[model samples]
Target: MQAGCTGCRSKADTFDIAMAFQPIVDAETGRPFAYEALVRGSNGEGAYDVLSQVTPENRYAFDQQCRVTAIELAVAAGIIDTGARLSINFLPNAVYSPVACIQLTLKTARATGFPPDRLIFEFTENEEMADTSHVKTIVETYRKMGFATAIDDFGAGHAGLGLLAKFQTDLIKLDMDLIRGVDTSLPRRMIIESVVRLCENLGITVIAEGIETVAEYEALRAIGVRYIQGYLLARPGFRTLPEITLPGGSIAAAA
Candidate 1:
């Protein structure tokens, strides 16, 4: 179904599906680790599109499909078990929908025999949130329902530490920019270190995103960042879990 770009024009029916991988490490070991699921789309012309364009009304539908497809693919490949968590992104507006995306997620988990705790919803930082009070209520509600919540691209936008304080997030993914020059910039390292300390004090886990080099990985590890995701680890693809291994002989499928 084609949707109007502006006004009421129609668009294409095909939505592309591509996967991006983010490493989820063992909090204690700081190792190359389990991969999180990312969804992407391609227009019929072969250009990749930003997921944000999908209307909030349709965002959950698209993302939930990706989650289910990823899980089914993993299961058919005999990789991921019902025990593994599948992290998916959700737009803020989805939170306001009467059928909140969280409910769809819980349903998917139940149908697949995946524990609710095994599903993590990563909300983007770019969208304008509806109401902080309502957002926090939804987040806490999800947590109480056994699902984990994370603020994607945490340090990249105005959300900053304020959102961290407001929401009881289970994970905070550091922006890629912070991870890129971390090995050389003392100030950057120090900033991340302080955030790490703050998150630690709050009992929230920190993840360093876009680590494309050994230097970056080691630098993040040194600063107490436990999780890392980047090209150096593994690129996102359709393969099942446990099929890929990390630098230390750790398997992504094992997660």
Candidate 2:
């Protein structure tokens, strides 16, 4: 850990936490493209149990710890050798300084021998950004450091196209509300198609999240979406990395 990380380390005494992982598979190859690290209680409780304890004072610590723990556990689970990316949800508001806050993460990744290029820092829409400039700095800095950045829950939050226009992100996760029943709804399909097109134009990869059925999955695949994540593939494995099961397609085996 860096010298600047002392504040967060001191604040880390507030809570105990763990992680769960769900694979985000490639639509064409059915291979694990990434594993999103979801927070959980150390005793196997829900995310709420862990997140409810996060306050402004400890937010920085919590965010830092989450990144370190996720990478540590993923390394222990051999995810570093799987050639799959690790998607870690980060609290942009908690990040006081992008360069300073990232030192611990850099140290942890290096210690574990995980590839920095394969790390994806996902910013959630639920966390209202008080300063867009700070958020932009975080994204830009992370990208320059050889890590990918993404906007999570796109349609469900205030930071939609407007925010995307202000900063560059490598990917955006389509919210479940926009994807639910999209297979049967023309309007939903049209909306998703338009979003996909817009993202494609901006050179941002689109990931359809929260898919629950074969119909939804097929619909997304047909829409030319190459990346996907949801219970239809695998649920978050509490303190573990869940196995991925790909739907039958032209590709016979897991890539």
Candidate 3:
């Protein structure tokens, strides 16, 4: 097994799972800034694949382990500072086992001296939320414990908008699909503009993903979307972090 495979063999049988951080930048700035940790799996071919093929019952377990490993790697690599934040995505169902995951995360953070306040949990809105009340309770518990919460893929999920209204999210990642051609598509542009406005009104920060063109970047910036993550700026990979340069060419290190 590779160095990062902690729970791959014990719980979900054999699989090669790894975690990599994708830098999220301030749209105005071109610098590589905040890192969004992503999980990938390999089937002995030495190539990483999406974890979606795992059985639903075991996927959460694998994901939680990936979160732990990702944080560990970041700390070891010195990519994350005591005050700098790291974002990790989770499925809605993972909240059902919030306590266990929380305990593990806290343990790993303590071991690496990574501050709990610098950790953000991003819940993907793609899956059907099994129980909203339970999820709300779980999110509230984590919030009180000093972890930031975010809703991922906001514009393409079943409960995307509804979840945003119900939960107090520190961040909302705009679905890439919704943003792909937003620069030229009037209808899509309008939808994104409205969502951006709504998020601003709610005092929530918005992050536009899958940005691959200068036009898309400019359009998103014009509409007041602040943070962005996509191939246009930087592909997700392991390397020395890059300085983020704003649209106007002002560069700054990650805070």
Instruction: Give the top-scoring candidate (lDDT).
Output: 2
Candidate 3 C-alpha lDDT tens digits along 18-89:
656677886554554467777654322222356645666566566667677778877765665524478887
Candidate 3 clash figure, as a count? 10
* Candidate achieving the largest TM-score: 2
lDDT of 2 by residue, 46-77 (tens): 99988888887678788898999999988887
The Cα RMSD of model 1 versus the native structure comes to: 5.3
- The CA-based lDDT of model 3 is what? 0.72
lDDT of each candidate versus the true structure:
0.63, 0.86, 0.72
lDDT: the better of candidates 2 and 3: 2
Which ten residues in a row are the worst by lDDT in model 3? 1-10
Q: Which 10 consecutive residues of model 2 have the lowest summed lDDT? A: 246-255
Q: Count the backbone clashes (under 3 Å) in each candidate.
A: 6, 0, 10
Q: Where does candidate 2 clash, by residue pair?
A: none
lDDT of 1 by residue, 133-179 (tens): 76787678877777677887877776777777777688888888877
Error of 2 at 139 (Å): 0.6
**Candidate structures ordered by TM-score, highest first:** 2, 3, 1
